[model samples]
Target: MSILLILALVVAMGAVLYALVRGVIAMANGKDVSGEVQQGYMQKRVLYQGIAIVIVVLLLVVAKSNGS
Candidate 1:
């Protein structure tokens, strides 16, 4: 459980970070983007990625710990 949690958290954080960086760059470049467009990207890329990664990491960690 713990291992899986860790993996998930890592994945989640990584995804969010990636999205944030990309989003910031896009905004900095002065691209014409709508509120929905920005929000959609963040939610789909960062939020979703982060959640998925965290869950996977946590599961892996927990499984390894238990097995060991």
Candidate 2:
């Protein structure tokens, strides 16, 4: 179970990184002058960040329970 959670955390972190880089690239490219494309990526990044945070909290909880 802990291993599964760790794997999920890694995937979530990777998603967050991917979103951030994509968003940065889109913004830097200036292809979407209206900023719509960048906004979508930003939203995805935030969502992934939230997921990562939740996973981290779960990991902490699991660790605490195991240690106790």
lDDT of 2 by residue, 11-51 (tens): 99999999999999999998899999999999999999999
Prediction 1 global C-alpha lDDT: 0.68
TM-score per prediction, in order, is 0.54, 0.96
**Cα displacement (Å) at residue 13, model 2:** 0.5
The clash tally of candidate 2 reads 0
What lDDT tens digits, residue by residue, belong to model 1 across residues 1-68?
Answer: 47556766776777777787776666676664565556665666756675776577667776878899
Candidate 1 has its poorest 10 consecutive residues by lDDT at 32-41
lDDT of 2: 0.97
Candidate 1 contains a number of clashing pairs equal to 22
Q: What Cα-based lDDT does every candidate model obtain?
A: 0.68, 0.97
